[model samples]
Target: MAEEELKIEEGGKKGKLMIIIIAAVVIIAGGAAAFFFLGGSDDDMADVQAVEGQAGAAPSASTGSAKSGTALYVAMPRPFVLNVPGAGRDRLVEIKVQLMVRGSDSEELAKSHIPLIEGTLLQVFSSSNADDLVTEAGKIALREQSLRDVQAKMQEIAGADVVEEVLFTGFVMQ
Candidate 1:
Protein backbone atom coordinates (compact mmCIF):
# COMPACT_ATOMS: atom_id res chain seq x y z
CA MET A 1 0.00 0.00 0.00
CA ALA A 2 2.92 2.44 0.81
CA GLU A 3 4.55 1.69 -2.55
CA GLU A 4 1.28 2.37 -4.33
CA GLU A 5 0.95 5.76 -2.52
CA LEU A 6 4.52 6.73 -3.48
CA LYS A 7 3.79 5.96 -7.14
CA ILE A 8 0.70 8.12 -7.05
CA GLU A 9 2.66 11.03 -5.57
CA GLU A 10 5.32 10.73 -8.29
CA GLY A 11 2.65 10.73 -11.00
CA GLY A 12 1.08 13.92 -9.63
CA LYS A 13 4.49 15.64 -9.61
CA LYS A 14 5.09 14.60 -13.19
CA GLY A 15 1.73 16.04 -14.23
CA LYS A 16 2.54 19.38 -12.62
CA LEU A 17 5.96 19.46 -14.31
CA MET A 18 4.36 18.80 -17.68
CA ILE A 19 1.90 21.65 -17.19
CA ILE A 20 4.72 24.08 -16.32
CA ILE A 21 6.67 23.13 -19.41
CA ILE A 22 3.65 23.58 -21.64
CA ALA A 23 2.91 26.99 -20.10
CA ALA A 24 6.49 28.10 -20.78
CA VAL A 25 6.23 27.05 -24.42
CA VAL A 26 2.97 28.91 -24.84
CA ILE A 27 4.40 32.09 -23.36
CA ILE A 28 7.46 31.97 -25.63
CA ALA A 29 5.30 31.44 -28.70
CA GLY A 30 3.06 34.37 -27.77
CA GLY A 31 6.05 36.67 -27.34
CA ALA A 32 7.47 35.70 -30.73
CA ALA A 33 4.15 36.28 -32.42
CA ALA A 34 3.83 39.75 -30.90
CA PHE A 35 7.37 40.68 -31.95
CA PHE A 36 6.74 39.74 -35.55
CA PHE A 37 3.47 41.63 -35.72
CA LEU A 38 4.51 44.78 -33.87
CA GLY A 39 8.15 45.29 -34.91
CA GLY A 40 9.03 48.15 -37.25
CA SER A 41 9.34 47.22 -40.90
CA ASP A 42 12.53 47.62 -42.93
CA ASP A 43 11.06 50.48 -44.92
CA ASP A 44 10.32 52.41 -41.74
CA MET A 45 13.83 51.85 -40.45
CA ALA A 46 15.32 52.99 -43.76
CA ASP A 47 13.34 56.21 -43.64
CA VAL A 48 14.47 56.90 -40.10
CA GLN A 49 18.07 56.24 -41.01
CA ALA A 50 17.85 58.55 -44.01
CA VAL A 51 16.55 61.36 -41.86
CA GLU A 52 19.27 60.73 -39.26
CA GLY A 53 21.92 60.87 -41.97
CA GLN A 54 20.67 64.18 -43.26
CA ALA A 55 20.57 65.68 -39.76
CA GLY A 56 24.02 64.34 -38.90
CA ALA A 57 25.48 66.02 -41.98
CA ALA A 58 24.74 69.44 -40.39
CA PRO A 59 23.76 71.09 -43.60
CA SER A 60 24.26 74.86 -43.59
CA ALA A 61 20.71 75.50 -44.69
CA SER A 62 17.71 73.50 -45.91
CA THR A 63 17.22 75.07 -49.32
CA GLY A 64 14.48 74.26 -51.82
CA SER A 65 16.98 72.29 -53.87
CA ALA A 66 17.81 69.98 -50.94
CA LYS A 67 15.72 66.86 -50.61
CA SER A 68 13.31 66.95 -47.71
CA GLY A 69 14.14 63.86 -45.69
CA THR A 70 10.70 63.03 -44.23
CA ALA A 71 7.54 64.61 -43.01
CA LEU A 72 7.77 65.17 -39.27
CA TYR A 73 5.41 66.89 -36.87
CA VAL A 74 6.34 69.01 -33.85
CA ALA A 75 3.66 69.67 -31.30
CA MET A 76 3.58 72.81 -29.22
CA PRO A 77 4.11 72.11 -25.55
CA ARG A 78 0.93 73.86 -24.44
CA PRO A 79 -2.38 74.98 -25.87
CA PHE A 80 -3.03 78.64 -26.53
CA VAL A 81 -5.88 79.95 -24.39
CA LEU A 82 -7.17 83.49 -24.52
CA ASN A 83 -10.27 85.60 -24.62
CA VAL A 84 -11.54 87.10 -27.84
CA PRO A 85 -14.10 89.85 -28.23
CA GLY A 86 -17.41 88.66 -29.66
CA ALA A 87 -20.35 90.47 -31.17
CA GLY A 88 -22.31 90.23 -27.91
CA ARG A 89 -19.75 89.26 -25.28
CA ASP A 90 -16.15 88.15 -24.86
CA ARG A 91 -15.58 84.41 -25.27
CA LEU A 92 -12.75 82.14 -24.18
CA VAL A 93 -10.84 80.53 -27.06
CA GLU A 94 -8.40 77.64 -26.95
CA ILE A 95 -6.26 76.29 -29.75
CA LYS A 96 -3.86 73.36 -29.92
CA VAL A 97 -1.30 73.59 -32.72
CA GLN A 98 1.19 71.28 -34.39
CA LEU A 99 3.89 72.30 -36.84
CA MET A 100 4.68 70.05 -39.77
CA VAL A 101 8.21 70.10 -41.14
CA ARG A 102 9.79 68.50 -44.17
CA GLY A 103 13.06 67.30 -42.69
CA SER A 104 14.98 66.72 -39.46
CA ASP A 105 16.79 70.05 -39.71
CA SER A 106 13.51 71.87 -39.99
CA GLU A 107 12.15 69.84 -37.10
CA GLU A 108 15.04 70.84 -34.88
CA LEU A 109 14.85 74.46 -35.93
CA ALA A 110 11.18 74.67 -35.15
CA LYS A 111 11.63 72.96 -31.81
CA SER A 112 14.35 75.39 -30.84
CA HIS A 113 12.12 78.36 -31.58
CA ILE A 114 8.96 77.12 -29.94
CA PRO A 115 8.58 80.22 -27.78
CA LEU A 116 8.65 82.49 -30.80
CA ILE A 117 6.21 80.29 -32.66
CA GLU A 118 3.84 80.18 -29.74
CA GLY A 119 3.90 83.93 -29.42
CA THR A 120 3.22 84.35 -33.11
CA LEU A 121 0.28 81.95 -32.97
CA LEU A 122 -1.13 83.67 -29.90
CA GLN A 123 -0.97 87.03 -31.59
CA VAL A 124 -2.79 85.67 -34.63
CA PHE A 125 -5.45 83.86 -32.64
CA SER A 126 -6.09 86.75 -30.30
CA SER A 127 -6.54 89.12 -33.20
CA SER A 128 -9.62 87.15 -34.36
CA ASN A 129 -13.16 87.91 -33.17
CA ALA A 130 -15.24 85.15 -31.65
CA ASP A 131 -18.07 85.76 -34.13
CA ASP A 132 -15.75 85.19 -37.07
CA LEU A 133 -14.30 82.08 -35.46
CA VAL A 134 -17.79 80.57 -35.53
CA THR A 135 -17.59 80.25 -39.33
CA GLU A 136 -15.55 77.64 -41.25
CA ALA A 137 -14.13 80.23 -43.61
CA GLY A 138 -12.84 82.28 -40.68
CA LYS A 139 -11.01 79.23 -39.30
CA ILE A 140 -9.40 78.55 -42.69
CA ALA A 141 -8.31 82.13 -43.04
CA LEU A 142 -6.85 82.08 -39.54
CA ARG A 143 -4.90 78.91 -40.33
CA GLU A 144 -3.53 80.41 -43.54
CA GLN A 145 -2.49 83.54 -41.74
CA SER A 146 -0.78 81.53 -39.04
CA LEU A 147 1.17 79.46 -41.57
CA ARG A 148 2.32 82.53 -43.43
CA ASP A 149 3.41 84.31 -40.26
CA VAL A 150 5.26 81.28 -38.91
CA GLN A 151 7.02 80.72 -42.23
CA ALA A 152 8.05 84.35 -42.40
CA LYS A 153 9.42 84.23 -38.85
CA MET A 154 11.33 81.01 -39.54
CA GLN A 155 12.79 82.42 -42.72
CA GLU A 156 13.97 85.45 -40.81
CA ILE A 157 15.74 83.30 -38.22
CA ALA A 158 17.00 80.36 -40.33
CA GLY A 159 16.97 81.72 -43.88
CA ALA A 160 14.73 78.73 -44.80
CA ASP A 161 11.13 77.71 -44.48
CA VAL A 162 11.31 75.52 -41.41
CA VAL A 163 7.58 74.98 -40.95
CA GLU A 164 5.43 73.64 -43.76
CA GLU A 165 2.04 73.88 -42.10
CA VAL A 166 0.32 75.16 -39.00
CA LEU A 167 -2.25 72.52 -38.06
CA PHE A 168 -4.96 73.27 -35.53
CA THR A 169 -5.38 69.89 -33.92
CA GLY A 170 -7.90 71.21 -31.44
CA PHE A 171 -10.04 74.33 -31.26
CA VAL A 172 -12.66 75.38 -28.79
CA MET A 173 -14.58 78.58 -28.15
CA GLN A 174 -16.92 79.18 -25.30
Candidate 2:
Protein backbone atom coordinates (compact mmCIF):
# COMPACT_ATOMS: atom_id res chain seq x y z
CA MET A 1 0.00 0.00 0.00
CA ALA A 2 2.80 2.46 0.87
CA GLU A 3 4.51 1.86 -2.45
CA GLU A 4 1.22 2.35 -4.33
CA GLU A 5 0.56 5.65 -2.54
CA LEU A 6 4.05 6.90 -3.38
CA LYS A 7 3.56 6.05 -7.06
CA ILE A 8 0.20 7.86 -7.13
CA GLU A 9 1.77 10.95 -5.53
CA GLU A 10 4.59 10.95 -8.11
CA GLY A 11 2.05 10.70 -10.94
CA GLY A 12 0.03 13.64 -9.57
CA LYS A 13 3.19 15.75 -9.29
CA LYS A 14 4.13 14.98 -12.91
CA GLY A 15 0.67 15.84 -14.13
CA LYS A 16 0.68 19.16 -12.28
CA LEU A 17 4.11 19.99 -13.68
CA MET A 18 2.95 19.29 -17.23
CA ILE A 19 -0.11 21.52 -16.83
CA ILE A 20 2.07 24.36 -15.44
CA ILE A 21 4.48 24.09 -18.36
CA ILE A 22 1.67 24.24 -20.91
CA ALA A 23 0.09 27.26 -19.23
CA ALA A 24 3.43 29.07 -19.20
CA VAL A 25 3.94 28.42 -22.90
CA VAL A 26 0.45 29.71 -23.72
CA ILE A 27 1.00 32.87 -21.68
CA ILE A 28 4.31 33.53 -23.37
CA ALA A 29 2.82 33.05 -26.82
CA GLY A 30 -0.08 35.40 -26.04
CA GLY A 31 2.32 38.10 -24.85
CA ALA A 32 4.38 37.83 -28.02
CA ALA A 33 1.30 38.03 -30.22
CA ALA A 34 0.08 41.15 -28.44
CA PHE A 35 3.42 42.87 -28.78
CA PHE A 36 3.57 42.19 -32.49
CA PHE A 37 -0.01 43.27 -33.16
CA LEU A 38 0.39 46.50 -31.24
CA GLY A 39 3.81 47.37 -32.62
CA GLY A 40 4.37 50.78 -34.24
CA SER A 41 5.14 51.05 -37.95
CA ASP A 42 6.87 53.59 -40.22
CA ASP A 43 3.60 55.03 -41.54
CA ASP A 44 2.36 55.62 -38.00
CA MET A 45 5.60 57.42 -37.20
CA ALA A 46 5.20 59.60 -40.29
CA ASP A 47 1.62 60.51 -39.32
CA VAL A 48 2.82 61.47 -35.85
CA GLN A 49 5.46 63.67 -37.40
CA ALA A 50 2.88 65.27 -39.68
CA VAL A 51 0.63 66.09 -36.72
CA GLU A 52 3.59 67.76 -35.01
CA GLY A 53 4.44 69.76 -38.14
CA GLN A 54 7.84 68.10 -38.60
CA ALA A 55 9.16 66.13 -41.55
CA GLY A 56 11.82 63.43 -41.70
CA ALA A 57 14.65 65.32 -43.44
CA ALA A 58 15.46 67.92 -46.07
CA PRO A 59 15.54 66.84 -49.68
CA SER A 60 18.33 67.72 -52.09
CA ALA A 61 18.59 71.35 -53.24
CA SER A 62 17.92 70.31 -56.81
CA THR A 63 14.51 69.01 -55.73
CA GLY A 64 13.03 72.45 -55.31
CA SER A 65 9.29 71.66 -55.35
CA ALA A 66 6.84 70.52 -52.65
CA LYS A 67 6.47 67.05 -54.27
CA SER A 68 10.14 66.14 -53.90
CA GLY A 69 10.29 65.36 -50.16
CA THR A 70 8.43 63.62 -47.36
CA ALA A 71 4.92 64.99 -46.88
CA LEU A 72 4.01 66.72 -43.61
CA TYR A 73 1.06 68.76 -42.38
CA VAL A 74 1.28 72.00 -40.42
CA ALA A 75 -1.92 72.97 -38.60
CA MET A 76 -2.90 76.56 -38.23
CA PRO A 77 -2.93 77.81 -34.66
CA ARG A 78 -6.59 78.93 -34.71
CA PRO A 79 -9.78 78.31 -36.64
CA PHE A 80 -10.84 81.06 -38.96
CA VAL A 81 -14.17 82.62 -38.08
CA LEU A 82 -16.00 85.05 -40.35
CA ASN A 83 -19.33 86.06 -41.81
CA VAL A 84 -20.47 85.22 -45.31
CA PRO A 85 -23.11 87.04 -47.22
CA GLY A 86 -26.15 84.84 -47.76
CA ALA A 87 -29.34 85.33 -49.76
CA GLY A 88 -31.29 86.54 -46.75
CA ARG A 89 -28.70 87.39 -44.11
CA ASP A 90 -25.04 86.99 -43.20
CA ARG A 91 -24.02 83.54 -41.94
CA LEU A 92 -21.18 82.87 -39.52
CA VAL A 93 -18.54 80.43 -40.62
CA GLU A 94 -15.60 78.71 -38.98
CA ILE A 95 -12.89 76.84 -40.84
CA LYS A 96 -9.86 75.01 -39.49
CA VAL A 97 -6.98 74.50 -41.87
CA GLN A 98 -3.79 72.50 -42.17
CA LEU A 99 -1.03 73.11 -44.68
CA MET A 100 0.64 70.12 -46.31
CA VAL A 101 4.28 70.58 -47.19
CA ARG A 102 7.26 68.47 -48.17
CA GLY A 103 10.51 68.21 -46.25
CA SER A 104 11.60 69.65 -42.91
CA ASP A 105 12.60 72.98 -44.42
CA SER A 106 9.13 73.57 -45.87
CA GLU A 107 7.53 72.60 -42.58
CA GLU A 108 9.67 75.07 -40.69
CA LEU A 109 9.01 77.80 -43.22
CA ALA A 110 5.25 77.27 -42.95
CA LYS A 111 5.31 77.20 -39.16
CA SER A 112 7.31 80.41 -39.00
CA HIS A 113 4.93 82.24 -41.34
CA ILE A 114 1.72 81.14 -39.67
CA PRO A 115 0.35 84.63 -39.13
CA LEU A 116 0.73 85.66 -42.75
CA ILE A 117 -0.69 82.40 -43.94
CA GLU A 118 -3.62 82.69 -41.55
CA GLY A 119 -4.39 86.17 -42.78
CA THR A 120 -4.27 85.07 -46.37
CA LEU A 121 -6.55 82.11 -45.68
CA LEU A 122 -8.97 84.28 -43.74
CA GLN A 123 -9.18 86.71 -46.62
CA VAL A 124 -9.90 83.92 -49.03
CA PHE A 125 -12.46 82.23 -46.79
CA SER A 126 -14.37 85.41 -46.00
CA SER A 127 -14.84 86.14 -49.66
CA SER A 128 -17.11 83.15 -50.16
CA ASN A 129 -20.89 83.50 -50.34
CA ALA A 130 -22.89 81.49 -47.84
CA ASP A 131 -25.02 79.95 -50.61
CA ASP A 132 -21.94 78.95 -52.53
CA LEU A 133 -20.13 77.54 -49.50
CA VAL A 134 -23.00 75.11 -48.94
CA THR A 135 -22.26 73.21 -52.15
CA GLU A 136 -19.55 70.56 -52.65
CA ALA A 137 -18.28 72.18 -55.85
CA GLY A 138 -18.10 75.56 -54.14
CA LYS A 139 -16.11 74.03 -51.29
CA ILE A 140 -13.66 72.54 -53.78
CA ALA A 141 -13.30 75.86 -55.51
CA LEU A 142 -12.65 77.57 -52.19
CA ARG A 143 -9.97 75.02 -51.34
CA GLU A 144 -8.28 75.49 -54.69
CA GLN A 145 -8.33 79.25 -54.38
CA SER A 146 -6.96 79.05 -50.86
CA LEU A 147 -4.14 76.81 -52.04
CA ARG A 148 -3.27 79.14 -54.88
CA ASP A 149 -3.23 82.25 -52.69
CA VAL A 150 -1.26 80.55 -49.96
CA GLN A 151 1.31 79.09 -52.38
CA ALA A 152 1.72 82.44 -54.08
CA LYS A 153 2.27 84.21 -50.78
CA MET A 154 4.72 81.57 -49.61
CA GLN A 155 6.57 81.67 -52.90
CA GLU A 156 6.95 85.43 -52.66
CA ILE A 157 8.26 85.17 -49.10
CA ALA A 158 10.30 81.91 -49.15
CA GLY A 159 11.12 82.03 -52.88
CA ALA A 160 9.47 78.57 -53.24
CA ASP A 161 6.05 77.00 -52.92
CA VAL A 162 6.31 76.23 -49.23
CA VAL A 163 2.69 75.08 -48.99
CA GLU A 164 1.64 72.13 -51.13
CA GLU A 165 -2.01 71.79 -50.16
CA VAL A 166 -4.59 73.59 -48.03
CA LEU A 167 -6.67 71.05 -46.14
CA PHE A 168 -9.92 71.97 -44.46
CA THR A 169 -9.71 70.02 -41.27
CA GLY A 170 -13.01 71.43 -39.98
CA PHE A 171 -15.80 73.57 -41.37
CA VAL A 172 -18.94 74.82 -39.69
CA MET A 173 -21.52 77.33 -40.86
CA GLN A 174 -24.47 78.83 -39.05
Candidate 3:
Protein backbone atom coordinates (compact mmCIF):
# COMPACT_ATOMS: atom_id res chain seq x y z
CA MET A 1 0.00 0.00 0.00
CA ALA A 2 2.85 2.49 0.72
CA GLU A 3 4.47 1.67 -2.62
CA GLU A 4 1.21 2.42 -4.43
CA GLU A 5 0.98 5.79 -2.63
CA LEU A 6 4.54 6.68 -3.65
CA LYS A 7 3.80 5.94 -7.33
CA ILE A 8 0.72 8.20 -7.31
CA GLU A 9 2.71 11.10 -5.76
CA GLU A 10 5.47 10.75 -8.37
CA GLY A 11 2.92 10.81 -11.26
CA GLY A 12 1.25 13.91 -9.83
CA LYS A 13 4.58 15.76 -9.62
CA LYS A 14 5.40 14.92 -13.26
CA GLY A 15 2.02 16.18 -14.46
CA LYS A 16 2.41 19.51 -12.58
CA LEU A 17 5.87 20.06 -14.09
CA MET A 18 4.53 19.53 -17.61
CA ILE A 19 1.69 22.04 -17.01
CA ILE A 20 4.16 24.68 -15.71
CA ILE A 21 6.46 24.29 -18.72
CA ILE A 22 3.58 24.56 -21.19
CA ALA A 23 2.28 27.74 -19.47
CA ALA A 24 5.69 29.34 -19.57
CA VAL A 25 6.11 28.62 -23.30
CA VAL A 26 2.68 30.07 -24.12
CA ILE A 27 3.38 33.26 -22.12
CA ILE A 28 6.74 33.80 -23.83
CA ALA A 29 5.26 33.33 -27.32
CA GLY A 30 2.45 35.79 -26.57
CA GLY A 31 4.91 38.42 -25.36
CA ALA A 32 7.07 38.09 -28.47
CA ALA A 33 4.08 38.40 -30.76
CA ALA A 34 2.83 41.55 -28.97
CA PHE A 35 6.23 43.18 -29.12
CA PHE A 36 6.65 42.60 -32.85
CA PHE A 37 3.14 43.80 -33.73
CA LEU A 38 3.02 46.88 -31.46
CA GLY A 39 6.57 48.15 -31.78
CA GLY A 40 7.12 48.83 -35.48
CA SER A 41 10.81 49.25 -36.40
CA ASP A 42 12.53 52.63 -36.90
CA ASP A 43 12.81 52.03 -40.65
CA ASP A 44 9.05 52.12 -41.08
CA MET A 45 8.80 55.53 -39.42
CA ALA A 46 11.57 56.90 -41.63
CA ASP A 47 9.80 55.72 -44.79
CA VAL A 48 6.58 57.45 -43.74
CA GLN A 49 8.45 60.70 -43.06
CA ALA A 50 10.20 60.53 -46.42
CA VAL A 51 6.90 60.14 -48.26
CA GLU A 52 5.35 63.10 -46.42
CA GLY A 53 8.40 65.26 -47.21
CA GLN A 54 8.28 64.39 -50.88
CA ALA A 55 4.56 65.17 -51.06
CA GLY A 56 5.23 68.65 -49.75
CA ALA A 57 8.37 69.35 -51.79
CA ALA A 58 7.63 67.91 -55.23
CA PRO A 59 5.62 69.74 -57.88
CA SER A 60 2.52 67.58 -58.34
CA ALA A 61 0.81 68.16 -61.65
CA SER A 62 -2.29 66.20 -60.56
CA THR A 63 -2.80 68.03 -57.30
CA GLY A 64 -3.43 71.77 -57.01
CA SER A 65 -1.02 72.50 -54.23
CA ALA A 66 2.19 70.80 -53.13
CA LYS A 67 1.44 71.86 -49.58
CA SER A 68 -2.26 70.99 -49.40
CA GLY A 69 -2.28 68.22 -52.02
CA THR A 70 -5.66 69.28 -53.39
CA ALA A 71 -6.87 69.60 -56.95
CA LEU A 72 -7.75 73.03 -58.39
CA TYR A 73 -10.44 73.26 -61.04
CA VAL A 74 -11.00 76.34 -63.22
CA ALA A 75 -14.26 76.66 -65.09
CA MET A 76 -14.39 78.38 -68.45
CA PRO A 77 -16.40 81.57 -68.47
CA ARG A 78 -18.60 80.47 -71.41
CA PRO A 79 -19.69 77.22 -72.97
CA PHE A 80 -18.25 76.23 -76.32
CA VAL A 81 -20.76 75.89 -79.17
CA LEU A 82 -19.55 74.21 -82.35
CA ASN A 83 -21.08 72.92 -85.55
CA VAL A 84 -20.28 69.23 -86.01
CA PRO A 85 -20.71 68.12 -89.61
CA GLY A 86 -22.60 64.91 -90.37
CA ALA A 87 -23.37 62.93 -93.54
CA GLY A 88 -26.80 64.51 -93.99
CA ARG A 89 -26.62 67.78 -92.07
CA ASP A 90 -24.53 69.62 -89.49
CA ARG A 91 -25.33 69.24 -85.78
CA LEU A 92 -24.70 71.81 -83.07
CA VAL A 93 -22.71 70.59 -80.09
CA GLU A 94 -22.37 72.63 -76.92
CA ILE A 95 -19.94 71.72 -74.17
CA LYS A 96 -18.87 73.21 -70.87
CA VAL A 97 -15.29 72.39 -69.88
CA GLN A 98 -13.27 72.84 -66.70
CA LEU A 99 -9.48 72.85 -66.54
CA MET A 100 -7.62 71.02 -63.81
CA VAL A 101 -4.55 72.99 -62.78
CA ARG A 102 -1.85 72.23 -60.24
CA GLY A 103 -0.65 75.42 -58.55
CA SER A 104 -1.73 78.99 -57.99
CA ASP A 105 0.54 80.14 -60.79
CA SER A 106 -1.04 77.72 -63.24
CA GLU A 107 -4.54 78.76 -62.20
CA GLU A 108 -3.70 82.43 -62.70
CA LEU A 109 -2.12 81.72 -66.07
CA ALA A 110 -5.15 79.75 -67.21
CA LYS A 111 -7.48 82.50 -66.08
CA SER A 112 -5.49 85.15 -67.89
CA HIS A 113 -5.30 83.21 -71.19
CA ILE A 114 -8.95 82.15 -71.24
CA PRO A 115 -9.58 83.72 -74.63
CA LEU A 116 -6.65 81.97 -76.27
CA ILE A 117 -7.57 78.67 -74.66
CA GLU A 118 -11.20 79.00 -75.72
CA GLY A 119 -10.19 79.59 -79.30
CA THR A 120 -7.92 76.59 -79.31
CA LEU A 121 -10.58 74.38 -77.76
CA LEU A 122 -13.21 75.59 -80.21
CA GLN A 123 -11.01 74.72 -83.14
CA VAL A 124 -10.56 71.21 -81.85
CA PHE A 125 -14.26 70.72 -81.10
CA SER A 126 -15.50 72.08 -84.42
CA SER A 127 -13.36 69.62 -86.31
CA SER A 128 -15.08 66.57 -84.76
CA ASN A 129 -17.64 64.57 -86.72
CA ALA A 130 -21.20 64.36 -85.42
CA ASP A 131 -21.35 60.60 -85.92
CA ASP A 132 -18.16 60.05 -83.94
CA LEU A 133 -19.42 62.10 -81.00
CA VAL A 134 -22.31 59.64 -80.48
CA THR A 135 -19.90 56.85 -79.51
CA GLU A 136 -18.26 56.49 -76.06
CA ALA A 137 -14.77 55.95 -77.47
CA GLY A 138 -15.11 59.01 -79.64
CA LYS A 139 -16.04 61.17 -76.67
CA ILE A 140 -13.09 59.86 -74.66
CA ALA A 141 -10.75 60.55 -77.57
CA LEU A 142 -12.14 64.05 -77.87
CA ARG A 143 -11.54 64.71 -74.19
CA GLU A 144 -7.95 63.44 -74.53
CA GLN A 145 -7.36 65.63 -77.55
CA SER A 146 -8.69 68.64 -75.71
CA LEU A 147 -6.36 67.97 -72.81
CA ARG A 148 -3.39 67.73 -75.14
CA ASP A 149 -4.32 70.92 -76.96
CA VAL A 150 -4.91 72.92 -73.79
CA GLN A 151 -1.73 71.62 -72.19
CA ALA A 152 0.26 72.46 -75.30
CA LYS A 153 -1.00 76.03 -75.33
CA MET A 154 -0.45 76.44 -71.59
CA GLN A 155 3.08 75.07 -71.98
CA GLU A 156 3.76 77.65 -74.66
CA ILE A 157 2.67 80.51 -72.39
CA ALA A 158 3.68 79.23 -68.95
CA GLY A 159 6.79 77.24 -70.02
CA ALA A 160 5.29 74.14 -68.35
CA ASP A 161 2.30 71.82 -68.59
CA VAL A 162 -0.16 73.85 -66.56
CA VAL A 163 -3.30 71.84 -67.24
CA GLU A 164 -3.54 68.25 -65.99
CA GLU A 165 -6.88 67.30 -67.51
CA VAL A 166 -9.83 68.79 -69.37
CA LEU A 167 -13.18 67.71 -67.89
CA PHE A 168 -16.47 68.09 -69.68
CA THR A 169 -18.97 69.53 -67.24
CA GLY A 170 -21.80 69.48 -69.78
CA PHE A 171 -22.23 68.01 -73.25
CA VAL A 172 -25.23 68.50 -75.56
CA MET A 173 -25.61 67.42 -79.14
CA GLN A 174 -28.56 68.73 -81.18
Q: In candidate 3, what are the lDDT values of residues 81-149, reduced to their tens digit?
A: 878998878999999999987656667777888998999899899889999898989899999999889
Clashing pairs in 3: none
Clashing pairs in 2: none
Top-TM-score candidate index = 2
Give lDDT tens digits, candidate 2, residues 1-174. Answer: 999999999999999999999999999999999988999889998897785555325653245567756788999998998999999889999999999988888898899999999989988988899999999999999999999999899878778888889999999999
C-alpha TM-score for every candidate: 0.65, 0.68, 0.63
Q: Pick the winner on TM-score between candidates 1 and 2.
A: 2
Q: Give the lDDT of residue 117 in candidate 1.
A: 93
Candidate 3 global lDDT: 0.82
Maximum-lDDT candidate? 2
What tens digits encode model 1's per-residue C-alpha lDDT throughout 73-135?
999999999999998999999999999887667788889999999988988998998998999
Residue 71 in candidate 3, Cα distance off native in Å: 0.8
